[model samples]
Target: MFKKEITAGAKSKVKSSVQRGIRTKVVETYPLLAPHIDEIIPKKSQLDLLKLPDRVSLYALNNEPLFWQHMDDAIVPHLRVVHQFPHCFSRIGIDRGAIRFVLSGAALMVPGLTSAGGQLPEPEGQLKEGDVAVIMAEGKEEACMVGQLKMGTEDMKEKKKGVAIDGGHCLGDGLWKMSID
Candidate 1:
């Protein structure tokens, strides 16, 4: 994985977008973003959000988000991925940066060998509903939900105020007491 430095202003914008569950436009003028459009965008639905010509990732959420409650243990070596959803997703092994691609309706997210270093030679596993995917970066082990996508602190703050009115989701694990706002 390539590491790049982001300016404070850009970071703030990204944070604001993620916090608001809004998509930010990638600025094509940035020197570092011209080569990775395809990698950052894998789906047609995400194309419109790329209007700025820069790569963008999710920044935030507005609704009660749902994640797999017990997804940490399913990791395995050379596991075959079977798709089970309409969207494309990946089950990435953290330590090796091996990525398994799946279309909807494929079986559990699993890994397959490829010659592209870490990239999958061919997409396997069709995506489908109720499918759980784990993504990890290179040189990393042990997966947790970590993506550049995030929400803005302002949105989180607003959501926190709604908690008293019974409308916010839990921000932390154990006792759904904390809200993101």
Candidate 2:
């Protein structure tokens, strides 16, 4: 949602109980991260919550941003944070042609993802509609966007020309450029 470089101000330290709750929600959402919870958010580390424009909430450790949520939506990890554990989340690859549009904060269309240049989860995989997905560009080593799927793999395969993913955090979006400090 962040299109401009917005400044995050007035951060408040999250209470231990609330921090634990955030940890629980994160672990529940990404089961693979369960084992790394302590390392990701140590009990002694100070966790602060910063409210941004458009009802977004950011959680950070020191000056490093860890994750954010838009309104009551699912928490999405920052690209820098997700880079630390690349394989933890499900992924979808878009064609090279769509990279620029995605970086510009456009909604991902099904055609770009269903084309020959794209890659989707295998039919038997558990990836479902509404799951958080890491959007990778063709031939890129790092993920370009973090978003929630609007349709399941099977459905995308059948109906291949509509919006496939909703609002996403991209490489140069305000969220990515925002300073937590």
Candidate 3:
């Protein structure tokens, strides 16, 4: 969703109760993050909220972006968060050819995931539409982007065309370049 180099509107300290709610919701959405939850968001730590354009709210700690949610939808972790706990999230890799486009903030295409250089969950049916996933590249060791799947893996295998991930935060997108300070 953070395509352009947008500006952060406000920075406010999140209330303890609200912070607890966000922490719970984040763990619920990403259960694998449970073990490192404390390290990711300490119980007594103060979290800050950065309001971005388009109703996107970014949660940060120690001037580092942690998680963000658009409206009341799923709370997606930042790429940095995913990188730190790479094994804790569902991942899909794109071909080398797709890397540039993804870094440029383009909608990920199906072929990028179905191609020989790409890699998806072993079974085409493992993932469903709207699932949040980390976008990895063919030769990269770290995730390049985080986004919600526009279509299921099964559908992508069958159709082999069209958008796979829409409006994701990429490695070089505005959000990635944005500083919490």
Which is the winner by TM-score between candidate 1 and candidate 3?
A: 3
Model 3 lDDT tens row, 28-138: 888889999999999999999999999999999999999988888788999999989999898888999999999888999999999999888867436889889998899
In candidate 2, where is summed lDDT lowest over 10 consecutive residues? 120-129
| lDDT (Cα) of model 2 | 0.87
TM-score of each: 0.21, 0.95, 0.96
Worst 10 residues of 3 by lDDT: 119-128
At residue 112, candidate 3 shows an lDDT of 95
| Per-residue accuracy of model 2 over 1-181 as CA lDDT, tens digit each | 6778889968999998999899999999988888887888887888999988888889999889998998888888888878888788888899999999999999989888889899888899846788899988899899999888888888998899888887778899988887755
Best by TM-score: 3
Tell me each candidate's RMSD, in Å, in order: 19.2, 1.2, 1.2
- Candidate 1 residue runs with Cα over 4 Å from true position: 10-90, 94-112, 115-141, 144-181
